[model samples]
Target chain A: MKPAAFKYIAAESLAQALALKAEYGDEAKWLAGGQSLVPAMNLRVAQPAVLIDLNPIEGMAGLTVKEKPTSEPHALVIKAMTRYRTLERSAEIATHCPLLHETMPHVAHPQIRNRGTLGGNLAHADPASELPAVMMVLNAKFKAQSVRGERWIAARDFFYTLFTTALAADELLTEIAIPLQPDTPTARTRTCFMEIARRRGDYAMMGVAASVTLDANGVCTDAQLGYLNAGDTPILATQAAQSLVGQSISAAQIQAAAAIARDEVQPPGNVHATVAFQRHLATVLTKRTLTTILDFRF
Target chain B: MLCKDFSLRFEMTDVTQKRCFVLFVIKMSQTTCPPKLLQIQNLKSKIPMSDLHTITATVNGKSYTRTIESRMLLSDFIRHELGLTGTHVGCEYGVCGACTILYDNHPTRSCLTLAVQANGHRLETVEGLAVSPTQLHPLQQAFHEAHGLQCGYCTPGILMTMKAFLAENPHPSEAEVREALSGNLCRCTGYQHIVDAVLNVKDEG
Candidate 1:
């Protein structure tokens, strides 16, 4: 397959990229990493008239820990072009956002991660992608910039629908800011990620990312679980997660939550997994993830 | 060795009078005859300047600057433009991982990227994996010894991918090697000997 003839321009600065986006409007596609977009282009599924290459923008492919004055949670600000391989290798990701670190291996193959950007994946909003679910579980905020200005979109509200985002056509996702879980013992956070695919590295039939913030007495203060391939978008199990809050999350409660999660998810059947089988996987993975998080020595 | 002083000069004259482009690849110090210049015929004559991009990139330690169509994938550029055909293209959509190459020290799917994107980037293909004309890199040697490939079509991409994998992992367990190889699809060897081939290499780290 071959991509159609298009005008390609590499933007050297963020301002230049925004200007190009403003100038070209919806006919232009912002090229970051091109891991997913280029493949769609090659398949003739997406035929943009202009591709604004964002790889060359200065200071656009790194991460920094932005600390607050102890009252507010610190943030891990990852530039838009930061590669997934970098996030996987970074000690900061493991420390600051364990859910993302654990889910990195399941995102794609190492080769794809070597070039795929977190911003690109999040912006692409693939319902089956691991990053969007993990980002949702992490409660990360996405920074969208345009020639007009910049605005922050919460991770939970970012994904609008299938392969779509809340982002406007002229807006480019510049960075992703994940608030670091405060290490205060009064509310310690632990996360677990798991997915079941027909084959390793393929999109999962079902996947779950669970984050639990336990109080000093081991009571669940906050339980956030995000599921991929469960619906039209990355689905957050609000009811299932709410069942664990303000309780010890006993084995029975875990089972109940799993059942609720299974019932709540609306999975599309594929050749690999039937609708019933996908619901079963949701039950199994939900229970397994909850149990794993509870079992971890906090 | 013979192209130590190689230079390519594009004659930009007569674009209005004649729309064709004549590229003169001058093989320097190869006798002062007129036949020494290899002419690349009609390089995108009718294409507008906006649709064609002149990009310079280094591959296998050799630099090439060519005006290519914007839609040309990096895999096509390496094969058709530079003639480094060692990197195979099994699936153009980056699924098969047969078009893998090292872009700026990271192994990437060349088919998923445009040649215009390779501007100012360093690329290493399967052809660059040898120490000399008579010598193979240790991984290639291990693959040869272990019979890692059967059809050999997917070997180039696998070699390039594994080269980067081994570099990063240094010493990986059998399971780790298999996990790293999950990105690449190989039908012939069932991945046993491919894993064996990877395990055979000794990482200095």
Candidate 2:
């Protein structure tokens, strides 16, 4: 079916988009990349009277990395509007964060990535999506701006509920800053991402992201674990993380963490899977992610 | 009570032409024919509409543009607007690859994109899959020789998808071909013949 007629305006700058959004309130929607919005409009789920297309806005799309002082670790800063295609092509993503590079190719397809922005995907915040879960595990921060002012929202706090974010209506996500995982001399951090879907390239029914930091003594100093489609938002299994921290990545420790993760998640039963099956998958995927990371073959 | 009777009014302006019109419609289905509806409908009929939204892009080697409604999908835009009806539309919700087209030099679901979105973008449809009007492209020829298509509804999109798949990976294995065309669905052919067709086309000079 065709969408209802609506007015379209291409915003030239960030200020214009904010002004239009503030003026129209819920009647308007900011069109960034249009990967999610266009489909929603076609399905009649969203029919904004006015669409403030932000593709032409200047200075909103770019990618760059900043190295900290010679003593400290570097910061690989990815702009919010940067397309996934850019991330896939960037030598920086491959060099600094090879795990992120490996995960980017599995996001939809090349055509969708050519237009889908990082900010748009995060903002959409589908529970079954991999990007939001990855962002949470990576501790990325979102920089948002509105006509009134600008603020930084941590990934942990940015996601409030299903499809809900801390972003104000007038605010536009302008940047995503990922602190480069430090490279220690003695012990290296291992990370991995995996998802199970009914069909390849489709949204995941259950997925996991894991980061494990080992000390010189081969003991886990820190662990970060995240699961998608397991709750209202991407939930971090703190219990699972705690179970692995300060312990060696032994079979028993990994099993204990996976068991805790399975008990911690309360995934909804959608068309893809049953609640019991998803909980089981959470355990299996958690074990798989941890094993992949510890083996340094992720 | 009054909440059920509430209606919202919005003004829509044509992007190409700076013409504006007000539209008011009641959301709830207790319709007694709102007077505002008639006024908007009458105003819409009065304007001398231009088919300016008709897009111009090169399909294969030829360039053409025709007037299209703002709501006309890119899939329909290629099939009807350009009079090259080789492209098919199935499961218009972007899942079925029957509407796949080479958009901006990549395989994209035309059904998922608006015609206006392709305003200045280069596009290639199934009509582009030919050496000449009388000759078939390698993929098309392979499909025929392999008996890859039965109903042929999904053949155009499969061919276009394979063409893009081969451009980047000229020597992909059988599994790679399956991974690339997973988005396209075919009911008649169990996709074995289609997979063989892609493999055979890769061997063409």
Candidate 3:
């Protein structure tokens, strides 16, 4: 019931942490909050020689609203280092971006939320995680930095496979930018997130995030849906989104999109839910999520 | 792998047929750790710290510093180091809630947390219950009144979890308590008495 011995250092700053990472290469890990890293270390699944604790690193946590590159309503720029608790506590996010708020509470217990960081969660890159799915739906931009330089990676291309991201070994996730969509008279935008898990605080068996935007004529202008625990990476339901665009919100159209999403995902079998059941749940949840999004009286 | 051999004397044929029930209750007290740290004099050795890393933390209302190995977990610090053995270590990977403790009013798994992580944090263990050494906290009293414990290995963890849960939502309904305790598993008492204990806390207040 004890972990194997390892050295630990509470890094003074991000630069120091990155320097340590660069010195140790893959043998060193940056420990933030320890919600995920601690569990992995205790399980002996991940054994690093030294851990550069990031808790002491200043100015690395917070939620900030930034200006997007384009005037497009869907383009929102949200900072990445935001804590889940900060987002969960934000009334603005709840009112403006209810999909993000809805999915935040399902990440883990409140205690874990107090310590878990959005950057760590995204960088950990569990396909079943809510943030990854939400990021995909938002088409968020990730800014990764190292001792050398920085680069932006799109959410779609960021997550390559299970527990894998485009991030290099030494790089740190600095920020995430999400597009902003204002609920105005001109643009009737709707969003909903739904998931089915065996127990609370457990990973989702199947989850869906849907963002539906409609024109004045009630024709779907754009649709972006993200599926979690349904594939190797957080996948965008392109077929589902395509099936809904330019079409009126109809049960038939929703069904077609659900079918497309269900057929598209290659869900792996796990103890929480089977592949077939997960596929079925994906269809059911996608339809339900869309229905909730469309049912908004705004 | 190194070779090892040992002999165990038992009439398996006779014992097996008599009772399958007794098998599960057998408690093994053998220590998994080595008895003493032996120095390999002939080997090239970079002398490590003579004393293990010392961690200072406030437990309950008392503060103490204990020397612990780098591998020592918070649960081990609370249990073996400080002799507050109430905190049970189970499913060391942090999935099981048997090692849950209140670290500065936040519930955390001690098994998954390092002792060094608690340096400046306030940790309240199951031993923190009761004002003095003799009295029982409301939750602990309720457990006894409701017969909440059978094989009490999980009792301390259950008490710690219930205490925190009640602090947040004092008058939680039966279903709410059930949802809150979903992370902590108890193999004995069918969880009926544990539920009863938490329900008693709600009624008492």
Winner by TM-score: 1
Residue range A187-240, candidate 2, lDDT tens digits: 577788888877676666788888888877888888989888788789899999
TM-score of chain B of each: 0.75, 0.72, 0.73
Worst 10 residues of 3 chain A by lDDT: A72-81
User: Candidate 1 - CAPRI tier?
Assistant: incorrect
lDDT (10s digit) by residue, model 1, range A195-230: 997668777889999999899999999998899988
In model 2, which runs have C-alpha deviations exceeding 4 angstroms?
Answer: A70-72, B1-56, B61-69
Expressed as tens digits, the lDDT of each residue in B1-205 for candidate 2 is 1122324322222332221122423343466545333433444443233323556767776776666665567887887777778888876655567888888877887876777677667888887778898898888899999999999998888888888889989999999998887777788888999999899988774
TM-score-wise, the better of 1 and 3 is 1
DockQ: the better of candidates 1 and 3: 1
DockQ of 3: 0.15
Per-candidate TM-score against the hidden true structure:
0.89, 0.85, 0.83
What is candidate 3's lDDT per residue for A1-298, written digit by digit as tens? 3455567777888788888877765556677767777776675545556667777677887665554455654543454456677788887678767788888878876556656788889988778788899999987889988898889999889887656678877888888877678766557778888888766766777889999989888888899989888776887889889889989889988998999999988886554467899899989999998988887644
User: Which one wins by DockQ: 1 or 2?
Assistant: 1
Task: State the lDDT at A89 in candidate 2.
Answer: 83
Which regions of candidate 3 are displaced past 4 Å?
A66-86, B1-52, B173-175, B189-193
- Model 1 gets an lDDT of 0.84
